[model samples]
Target: MITQSGPSPDGYDPRADRDLPPASGRGDPHRVPEHFPGVSHHEPIGLRRRLALNRMGTFDWDLDRGFMDLDPGALEVFDLRPDEYDGAPMSLVCRVPPEEGIRLDAALSQALQAGTSSYGAYFRVRCRDGTPRWTHSQGRILHDADGLPYRIIGIVREASGELADSALLHSLQKERQRQTVMVQQVTVALSRALSVADVTRVLTGIGGARRFGADGLLLGLTAGGRFEVIAVAGMGGDVPEEMLTSQLDDTLPLSEAAVSRRPSFLGSRGELLARYPRLRPYGEVLPTGSSSFLPLIAQDTVIGALGLFTTEPAVQSTEARNLALALAGVVAQSLQRATLFDQERELATGLQATMLPRRLPEICGGEVTVRYHPASVGRDIGGDWYDVIALPQGRTGLVVGDVQGHDTHAAAVMGQLRIALRAYAAEGHSPETVLVRASRFLAELDTERFATCTYVQADLKSGALQVARAGHLGPLVRDGARHVDWPEVRGGLPLGLADAFGHDHFPETQLFLEPGSTLLLCTDGLVEQPGRDISAGIDALSAAFGAGPEKLEELADRLSAHLWAEPGSEDDMALLLLHRPAGSGAATTPRLRLHVHQADPSGTAEVRSALRRTLDQWRAGEVTHDVEVAASELIANALTHTESGALVSVELLPDTPRRIRLEVEDRSSSWPRRRSPGETATSGRGLLLVEALADRWGAEPRGSGKALWCEFVVPEMPEASARVR
Candidate 1:
């Protein structure tokens, strides 16, 4: 054996090494050498054999001397010869990469300082051949009798394959987490979308473009068997107008995607050009590198298609495609719901319009105008209506009502209630009696809906108004100075609720309208809003009413504009305004005038012929036959009842709706009573016949002579004819 002197490259003295007992045998290295402290002298041969079979490298370290003894396998792992690296632990430490060498030194130091039994560290080491390998080193530390560290025996193994597998698994898990979060966020947003436009804005917005790496997006929907561009994003003014407005045929890619109900990809400009050569001339309008068309399918039906364009072809990945497909499914479902709602809303609105009054009746002292606004949210159809009914004796019935709920059922119920109210009022019922009968009728129908209504019957000649309310807002009255005031009116329960609770009495409040006063009747929607009390809306309405344009139509427009300036209201509004003009008498120049003697039955015929000619001249020939029959009845009654001959007068009242007024006067001071005639009685039906033929008819005492008068609402004349006379 050779005796090395001094430090031997690891600062180990050869004199100290010689102090330990010699090895048992060269072939049996398993026999613990005296210098290796942690090894047993009688160690099992199986442990040493197993380590050698698996090709694990082993080393022994002297803690006090700072020296290492490497086995032949250990030296082979470092790619060094036994002569070059044997007993040189410093050289072995130098072979490790700098950072890993420091880590290994720290582990050994910790084990020695703490007097621990084991130490382990994993790090990269560079072999003498300049190859890097990941390694895990584990060792056991032994102490001397004085409790000072003496030696360490350890084994090292390669761990490169295990680390690579762990790293791949971690990356895959992170990507899965990210995808799950994205899908959840998109699902929540799509659920809240209320309309097709709302869905389109969310789909092509910022979040969508970033996730799919799309430069532009286009949405096409199938309508009437043709593809139409419903929405677009990121396409600037460069896109042609034809692409937006014109319908697409089956040959187009969008139509193909919808027909096939599958996603299709256009990989390159050449692919697009090959299929759609017509788009080649507008190259800039097309995507640069790639495009994808996805079918939006819901419940096994294709409703539309989505198109995405990207500048780089490689940006379209499998993950992005799957995400797009999932989003398309969400959009398809939401759009289907929106489309059905829109169709139902339109039908409800049409039915509601038919139920409302086609034209407001023009009264002698007041001008009537109306405006209706549907709800701004959801289906947009609700139960709000206004009407002007011409009652007997030159009185007008003003009505505004709102049925509960904003649905088809509510609208249907509103129509029926309006007709019932008009019929009761036309049959000479008082304001309070009309509402009581209407409530009973509504309850009998069993529609399970309630309604709030306000009805006002105004005597135009006397300016006396009788108002009855059924849980509705009282009318706003504007004075001569345009100061608005809400009159005190006691209200009963809503229509259906009154009969349900055994309460049918609706009290009437009488109001005298001064000349130039304006009466406004409106549904609750006009003065009610979410998050704001109805009182606040009432205040705003009062302010709007005070500031008027003086013209009835313009004032109506102004009221609607001011009330609904801010949108998102979920109620329908109906407003009716009746402005009584300053003067209360007849016009100086009537459209037509006739005078006849009532005694001669032949005079009735003469008066009828003269009335026909005058109505024809006024372009009101539509009411000529009705007016003539009414005149004949009134003149016959005057001749038969009164001893003196009567004066027959026919004058057309100048108003928006032209009126033909027929008055027959006799010296007798008797008023005609509308008697109930039996089915077979022909004589007592004369006054009843006149009432049925005329819009309004009654007998008024004029000084000593009683004037039996009736008014017929004639067709409005053209602008040129109205201006003529």
Candidate 2:
């Protein structure tokens, strides 16, 4: 039976026990007297009531009895009704989050098994409203006489109000630091990009995706007021081509961003679909709950746009949007520069192509090919040129040259110099004389540009060559012995520099071409590069030449393909190859022999007729009329000047600049001389007439008499008539 206390004389409810101390008193009801002899039992009971008033709690568990008790404050912290908590430790522990409950149970079990005096833990617990709060609990274990755990008493307090806030602040700070580093990395990557393609590649690769935390990224560039998807990340080939190629006005989000020149965020799939109905299909495919569109602006111009998609709206934080804008700025600047570079490069390439030769000349008994490569860096135009000119008298002139500097000025000077060299060579000047005149011409114009040049004139009939070098690398020759060597030829000062400083004569080198021989002429770019010696380049070229293909065109391609394979080659390159076909005892020129009777002036007519016949047989009728007139003069001179029967020979030199050689041999030791013929003297006019009608005429003394020889140039025939019998 229980009795209720009545009202006291002081007007306080007598139901409240007067002997009981205030709730604030320190006391423990369950403490054994032996353990806490000085503490009163009412003191612990008062402490429990005070903790409950302060919203802090106390709990006690009789481990052996499997019963638990919680103060009103503990029940309130756990958000448990009186009936909900059954005074079982398991029932209270079940209120915690599943993982935290397991952890707390394991801690209690460990303390009980070890018979430890105390243990504490922080864990998550759910309130009656289903909201989670961090709670800290401390408990002490009581043991029985047998040294086994018997009871546990603990205090429980809500910690989330202060402790959780501190942890959240720390996490946010770390995230900010990580974002700063990511932005720095993106800036560095954009800085290294050299071209539009490079920028696009980097932005679409792993670097861009990781920084933005995007599920899909679309990069659209503006050209001619039209927008096109230049690159896409996270969306593989499955992205529709039409979506990538849409015009700027075709879409809402992209156009709106372009017009506003700011970033726009669609926070939910429903909003995106409602605002951009056309993008609904893509939204379904990408499964994006949020998306952002940013205008790529540079120098106040909207050059492009960027679209980023994320599956969860949480990923689209304020920090992420700021990062996206920063990344857009970097990409915009890099892409703008690259786009300009691409345009300029295309224009330069087209201009350079127009300046080169359209076709290479074809020569008999030899093959010729040329290649020109511009600088891989900067503008793709430089001052390098190669030309194959068909000189008079069955000879071909090959030229390769480089002008100082690598700009439009250098290229202009190079073109002028090439034309001047060709004009001088066509005028029948020797290689050295041509360079001397070219140097003078360049100096007079005063373009302030210097040039290095090499010229080689090869005679098709005799296989003889005349080479001249003007501050240029010597030609590499592969002889019939299969030996590759750079001919020993001293070069003069480069053109334009020599005449401006002092007058110097250019040197000429004479060489003969044996069967199966090849000549290679090139600019320094083909052999020289950064961190490499010119000598090493020359040696490497020699090796490449030695191992090159037998075909002349293929060999030129092979050498270029091998040398240009290395990166960072900034100089312009020009290469020319001249190869003589292989075969022993091959006649350089076609010959037709005829014996002329002595003391017969009429034999001159016969010689002309026979020469015309042979020219017809060789399919060289183009020069028949000139050959006849020149032959008639040479035959008449040989018969009238020498005291011997004439041996008339007509030989046709078949090459680019065809020539017909007429030689009339006699037994006299007299060489013909050129003289001004009087109107009355018909005999002296014959030699005069020969010089006027022929391309070149000369006299050589045979064993006893002189052989009067003259050559007439055969004009280039039609393509169909170029074939020889």
Candidate 3:
């Protein structure tokens, strides 16, 4: 027996003979430990046997001297003989692989540096026969009083079974996570696919292969008792032409998968070729890897097949097979949804196209071009539409409108409204009347929907445009000099809502489109972005229009490209561009017309201002005073005497001395008679002024009313000013 008070300052050395303080005077080294009472004296020996039986071992490492003492059990854990390991710890380097040794060292260093009392690590060690065995070690760090680690005491154990279970679980977890991510990403992308083409783009676009963790992919759809290769991806070489389209009975992998409605997994390219001898013709071009073909089945119907190729061994694990099936299920569902959407979109678009004019009528003096793009979100079919109606009297009615919803109901309403507006305009109704009737028609539909619209009754020969709006964006005008102007058009409530609210009055805006000018009417979709201001989009549109090509078709295409280049537009767009080419030979006489409503007190002032502006543009400023005075008198007399609006026209008549003609037409058949007025009484002075101011003034029977006309003689304009406008 030996007695020891404590460990040396260098730290405890387990090999040194030591004894616990004598407990109750018992000094037997092999006796039951003092800490264990009422136990047999053989207990200490039994404890050692139990440890050995459990393949548990102990070690004492002297950090300063780099020496380690391993018990027989630890040697067994490493599959090493007692004589195989030298006293130096480095002697075990041959047993532990380089990476494992580095990892163990780093763990121990971290524990020591962080002042931890213990650490544990699992690593692989080579056996005597060069077989790798799993081993685990748990160590207790011993430090000097100054906190410097000088020794380590720990246990080593055989961990093959424990680590094997843990590794399998970890691998399963990792694979599950990868599968989950792949499915989630693919599902999210396909959720937005609105058509067959859109689905193909998502699955075969850039990074499509990486998205599926596959090196190559092939996709085909079954149609008309045949298979069509809709898309192929990640193939390093071109696909054989024969594979592009084949019958269901064809001896092809994809075709068979589709026909059988079951998945097929091939171990390698050779296996695939061996199974399908017909593929030998293109074996050289095929990818060298394992492959899988999964039939895309929806509602128990096989619609297509998807193939995945990888430059690795066969997908043999149950997890891999399950992942492939799950991906196929997701793709199948998406394809089903996209197919349905495609069919519905086609039907809706067909209906919409049928409602619209098959072709824009060829205008006498201007060209009409139109474009329509449906919403890109899901299966939405918007109500946006455009129609070019050839109204009577050589006039053209350009209409662009959008109903309130994005469905067949809205499209139906749009079609009805378009026809109604077209009919009214062709019947020679005023722009304001046409809109009022259209609003009433929509309201009568008895649906909880409304619509916005802009109707322009254009007199190309006269270069006059009467524009009316119902809660729609104003039209943009591009002049001959490439200048763009968004005229301020007064608006009323939208179609159905106007009738519901009892405010169906849509004011007509007077516009003059000189030769070589373009009037662009488009829906809000063209200039509305998700997170940006609509004004900004409108500004951008203006800039693009101002700088666009001169040809109407080219300009429309360019504008469409500029505004709709990016995807994710939530609404449909309908754009109609009416371009009035510069007069053919000599410039047609420039003319301007305006309407003055009797109910509007400000109509007379607005018409007067418009007259001044038009005169200035036409370089007829010399007679602006006489023309304005006579026009004011005529308009006032018509409004005071008649019960309807007045139509005023200012024309630079192309005759000798270049006379300026002013005509005020009234709906009333009552003609104006020149009458002398009492100086004090303000009665019957209109015709007197017209008579005194004009070189020639008279009244004529026009359509359903009479026209009071006056002409002003002026000198010829400069050649530059009179050049073709």
Candidate 4:
């Protein structure tokens, strides 16, 4: 029975209304009202009654004039009285929410731009009681002879019942789908958690609130009859200290859920405060609306509880409840697994630490520091180790090694190997000999394990470094000027494999560490990261070392702190640092030590080269020729008379008249005796030559051996003698 002024492209014809009864006079049933100029009032009296009964109202809008007229029925649909609205379209805006009004405007504009003949839309209208009601509007565009839109005629009606019958079912289905997706995403994230820290990070990190569709999330664990808060996300205000830890029997909601192993739901914060009045102090900081607390259970054990909060009233449907419970189950499993991994890792790390030296030995003229860090991700211990052994002749031996594999067995092997290496080094064996014996010992063990090691024999008094490696990284040296470099050291096969491969020789490299310099030796773990080239890590380490603090302790701490910034490293690491301080003025004499094997023909030539180099550095080149001749004769006599190799030392004496002192030590007890012989006798002329070329000479008993010594006068260097750059 709804009427329109003109023919509606939406099937409403104005001609049909002409068949109704004629008007008697003013106020007749068949006459249109003056207020509703857009409505065709020629309808029958029964049609008007039927239209009013159905609660359908008609509207006419003049686009050109920017005005609209609503019938009495349309005013009823908007919950407005006849006297409340004007004839303008904007007069009805008070009934529609801002968001709904924007949507309706957009729809109308689209239809006008598209030149559509008709359009329909549904929107929410705010009632007088401040509740939103569903309403539908249908309009047909009317055009003039020029094909331009001049007016619009349509009808408006209440749609609450219609929406209740169809839209409700669709809303329920969408909510179910959302819940399922939440569960799947949470499960997938938890699967990668390997520790308690990892699990909490995944739950409380970015985007956590949106994934769970909650305004707040709180997670806790039960320990020693107390509940400990682990993570909190999306909560407002500061949390009290007492709330972070509470007894299991406390009246707190999370504690109750954990102890009872059940789920509790509260429709609002008011209900929570009413049920548990003890929570009143925390009410201001807690989330509003509804909240749910579910116990985290795994294998029939309650380990903790999880709390979820929303800002709106909860539906309390079966699917929502099930989703919460499923999420709780997934988290419980991950937490339990992570806890076990932590316990095992703790035990393994303790065992690994026990295998290392309890304390580094204090050495004169040098400061030493060591650090051992376990792998950050696994349950098994690694084989990295560090040791400092005090050797004879005021020297120190620095060792860093890693045994193959990560287990208790690896730790045991490392302990035995460390002891053996320490004993061999302390017995005055050379770096090459120490590693060969260590490899032989490991090969003899019943287990099939190998190790990589870098050993440095440091002569602090002489500033001499002899380095040897067995399939390991070479040591790094930082000079007094903060320049860092990695000296080349040749390597052999790894221990236990050296004997199997029939290669037991590890060649030694000689380096000079000036006073105030530092030597660094570490396992590869310190410079190795998964998927990255090792050279990059090495370069980074070198840069950090060059920029570190001057003090040994502070530098060691700074390097250790870098480990916290890098993640996902599966290997353990060991570090050793030795610093040689620059002593007072000329009192610190420059010295050099070179070892000469009994049968090594090249040993003499290498010693001569080292002598030239040391003399050039000290600006004592005036006596180089005499010192070289005397040293050669002494070395030949020792190699000829001693049953073992010799240790040669050359030092610049700091006295009124500076002198260069040379000492050749051998294992033979027989001392050198000056003897006169025939002119052509070659063997007897060695000592004669030493005695004639040196300004002074002597012999002394040095530990199970004899040290033949010589000295030569060296004039003060001229300023012009400095080497050209």
Candidate 5:
């Protein structure tokens, strides 16, 4: 057998006959090839009953799998001959009971799936002495690329004596006492072990750390409810060095017990083998002793499972098993809390997304595209929010705000402030008045938090925009010639800090559509970077917009991609953009004979209705009927499915001598895929219709979301192009 290059565990002595990794494949020349000196040494019960498995068993299974010959008398115990043995299957040499095989198979499968090193179970096998011996068989699985298991080696020891001996139970009753001492030792030593690496080394029995087994100890929570392992004194392999670091979570078996609030027995290795029958091929895969699974229950909850595992067929005495369970319990409690916290965070994220607008409103005067990209990091849902509020007074309320915290509580406050902004705005209040009331609403939020916001109310008639900023980033405006930034209202504080602070009236700033101008409103995530000036981010945005409508989409995508980091950024982001055709001048003073005003909302729903209204007013019959629903669905979809902090714009390209074109702009670069016909899964299918209806339709990234556009030729009016511009 081929042994590894590393030195064997302490006290292991190697000789020329010892098998190493890449063994010669020839049968081992040493008599009774085992981890010991010779057959005679292991034969005498009083001489060397311990397998010296802890000292380092056959290290090179690749070189050879040694099956030492038992005395001829021992072979008579089972009806087997040496000639019948095959290296491919140890089962061919050992007689394992049917139940034992099934049990062990199941265990191996669980171990492999869970990324655990060891899996063991108790089972009965036909012994060479014509006796049925119950034993625990445990194996360690080695994996390679593609996650396939290459080899599994296990140890088996007779457990029948322990199962039947009442006297042995008494002797083992004090196991828990030892476990208690170990827990105290591990806790006090915990401060000394800082990093994950340190923790790993300590778990491996270094620095006075307790050892459940001198051989292969799985230092994890017992499934029943304890922080311990199945103690095997004379076993095999170095105290595993990777278990601490390899674990995804510390709870393990304790979580199981905590959930059930009951003690658990490790399923038999025979059961494990039975479930993973293929593992049987690795060794005379059978059970050695019954194992126990303890749940680590904490605060009335199961955080993980702890396993007292072994390769012995007979169940250990209740006392020993309980000791294992108890030790595992302590470790489990801490791990469970951590896992529960992570779950809560995920739930918070879901709720935050739901709170944001799922769909944007549809407008007819011009096409408006919107995209929102959320930040890549944070513990829970963030405090950023955006809204499309259609006021009763003909103006559209575009608002975006950021609460001061990044948790579920922050999210709740955001929702409250959001509705209040709309309620006051819908009640005929101007953007400045709405901000004043919204500030008051936030001040009573029950928590000391601040909120910053930018509110804009765009009037369609004069193409005039009213903007109010409350301690938020300046607005970016691109008016044909160059990009311009609107400064803050001078003296304003983040909301909720003081009553008088919110009482200050925000000065409203108004600017005309300014011919080919574009307005960009976004959260600070768009401009803030650690150790970098805000101008750097602002410069990036300006440069992309300055490139004009031709490169606008591509540049937007590139910029958005740059914002995401590997370890991720700290805050949630919100970006909203409104672009009017630069030279063509959307909603600008008449310039084209037929001007098609792009009036669509940031979302897909309202955009479609607005598109249909425009087509109907122009008297395009089937053209309007055919794509009304399609346009609505596609445009609404553009609002969702991608990052929320996206730059979205829409354009109305009048077919100069013929048709009117409708274009939606966004930064998402992924090609829209079609799901199975009529998938109700809430994300696909919209793109399918866009492909079929529009003339020469395709997508390119806008500032953030990808623009999905289509063209429709109108025939009725000779001046149709003239009517659109």
Candidate 6:
């Protein structure tokens, strides 16, 4: 039997063990073995105190002696040991029930000898009625100075209760695990914060105090002493939207908890009522059971508190509290991070705009439009730039280029490259030559970035064009000999990839002008990007071009709209074009006839009047004086130089400034040259002055001495004015 050594206190009692028979020689055989399980280090514990312990007890070893002093129930169920195992160590004697053959004393003795002071063991032991049961016995071995085991005092407990408890504990643990995984998934989703309400709702519904899960809250207390919820999650049901949105009294329980910043539990019904008298009415009115309030503390001060509620009182488990606290921390961090990121993005967007073009300059020969979109705000804008330069020869140079990335540096490089290209082209270099030099210049800049470009040179005179593609889109040539002839790739390379790329550039290829022909040049960004293959983009352009060039501006707008159709087409782009007129420059100058006959001055005057009337009818009367003078001079030369044959010729042209210029010729080898001021006779002066007044005068041998001619400006001069006589 287990025992304590001292006299018993109130509510405690002693027990006697009389299992063994009287010994033959030891103490008249009255003392049998006794067990003192779980004894403290002292002289020894008597039997009285052991009986008072709720978790401790002794059992019968032999059936005979235990029945005398025990109650009938105890007697019927157990038998005391009278003679077995006298004075044995408690570790061995206590396990006499549900017996296993692995002698407890022997095993414990072995363990003690090995310097093991305390040990726990599991084994089957015999019960009082001889039933077998699994028992777990534990004990501490007392050692003497020589390091040998002197006594083992311990307790033996039935393992059944503990085993069942273990199963319950395992189930609880699994539930906690599932809850934890769900919380994590929701936390991840909420972290994205695509929308404030959505993110908050998702997180709160999953784990916030606002829903039926663990929840945390942040609130601002009003002048009153009641707590008002600001943000909430994990609580069962809504926070009475009014209660959450309205200001609460500072002295209220939740607010007080927040202000004090102390962690408190409100599980019992009485505790809930005492903490919040207002809640008493709520409970009476609604029949609620369990809740836990955790203060939202920052810098040692409560700013808010987390409240969790459940239908059962078990809602206040440790897991709930832990999750609530963690959720509170996450909300605070997310708030701070999102605010900072938004501010930073705004600043970046402003900076990007400063580097982009604001407006496009008006240029002649074709319309111009420019659009610059910074690479999605908060990111850098790429090095794409476009410039339309009016060249000296009445030609236009269209340039577009892209540097490597989207950043302030790339944008700066783009500006510099644009200026450089314009300067080069203005110096009279062909488009190909300009690209070659630009490439070499870009390569040597050492920016550790590459660039691509396409330059188009338009010849206003012949309406001719030359294109150079530097790792850029080939210029789209539509409605020429071939309706869709891309810029010829005779030889070109991108700028900046290497050093030797630009110096010895190939000669620019020439293309003949066709009526309604158009040439389009652009950066790679225009034709090559995601959401569509380069070929598809090219085809799209071809289709647009084939639709006729009248809708060019509309086409550009359509292109921009198409780009946004697929977000992946987020590359910088630009378009440039050169259009040719319907009539070719090489078309024969307009022909008409101008005749001078050997007639009277009145006849000449009559002819002049007729010419003036006809020219005036055609809106070309400005040429009447020059035509009259040249005709008079030609007729005078022909009449003076030869006998009687007269001729009149007229031609029209479409060139600028001199839209119409003409030559008067007669069969005379003697060309008209300006005579000396004094030597100029009347007839000689006529042709001489004609030679001087006309832009150009000449003579050719027309199966005769020569054909003399004098040129005169037509009525339709593009820029210069004509003087008629």
Model 1: lowest-lDDT 10 consecutive positions: 17-26
What is the per-residue lDDT of model 1 for residues 1-725, given as tens digits with 9 covering 90 to 100?
22344444334343432222222322322232333335576764444344444445667777667678765445544545556764756777656754345446545543553467788866666765566666678887766677766667677765555555697445544653565566566667777777777777777777765444467788888877777887777653466766654454546677778876667678876787788766676677776778888787776678889887777655455444555665566667888987787777777778879989887766776788999988867775788999899988889999999999887888888889999999999998998899999999999997889999999998767667788899999888876667666765656899989999987868666565656778899987788888998899899898889888778899999988778655656688899988878776533333222334443456667666656654554456678888888878877787887777766666666676778787888888877877897878768778888889899988888888899888888876577755543
In model 2, which regions exceed 4 Å deviation?
1-173, 204-208, 211-216, 238-240, 252-262, 266-291, 309-313, 349-351, 362-365, 479-483, 501-503, 514-517, 583-585, 588-725
**lDDT (Cα atoms) of all candidates against the true structure:** 0.72, 0.72, 0.79, 0.79, 0.53, 0.53
**How high is each candidate's TM-score?**
0.55, 0.54, 0.64, 0.62, 0.38, 0.42
Cα RMSD of all models vs. native, in order, equals 24.7, 24.3, 18.0, 20.1, 24.7, 24.5
The candidate, 4 or 6, that scores higher on TM-score is 4
lDDT of 5 by residue, 59-144 (tens): 21221243322212122222345465433344433586533443454455445545765667655566555566555555666565
For model 6, how does the per-residue alpha-carbon lDDT over 1-725 read when each residue is reduced to its tens digit?
44446433222233444342221212211122253445555755444333312123333222123221222212211222444334333433454531122234324423543477776654554555455444555666555577755444445544544545586556644754565555566457657763334444554554444332533433333335455554554333454554554334443456555655544556655666777776554444222456655554433334455555544455355444445555544444554454455565556556645544455545444444554444432234568777777788677777777888877788777777777888899898987678878877777677888788877776645655566667766566565333455533444456866355423453354443355566666665655666667888777666656554355666566655554234555665655555664564555333334345455344345445544543442345456677667766666667667655555554444455444344445555665565565654444477566766777876677765566565555545443332221
Candidate 2 lDDT over 615-644, as tens digits, reads 654556656887787777666766667667
Candidate 2, residue 85: CA error in Å?
70
Off by over 4 Å in 6: 1-175, 187-352, 374-380, 459-463, 477-491, 501-503, 510-521, 526-533, 536-554, 564-725
**What is the per-residue lDDT of model 3 for residues 380-492, given as tens digits with 9 covering 90 to 100?**
68899999998888889999999999988888888888888888989989889999999999889899999999999988886788899999998998888786777656678
TM-score of 2: 0.54
Better of 3 and 4 by TM-score: 3
Model 5 scores a C-alpha lDDT of 0.53
Q: Using TM-score as the measure, what is the rank order of every candidate, best first?
A: 3, 4, 1, 2, 6, 5
Q: Give the TM-score of candidate 3.
A: 0.64
After superposing candidate 1, which stretches have Cα over 4 Å from the reference?
1-178, 204-213, 245-251, 267-275, 286-289, 311-315, 362-365, 460-462, 479-481, 499-503, 512-517, 548-550, 561-568, 581-725
Q: For model 2, what is the error of residue 3's alpha carbon versus the real structure, in angstroms, after optimal superposition?
A: 87
TM-score of structure candidate 4: 0.62
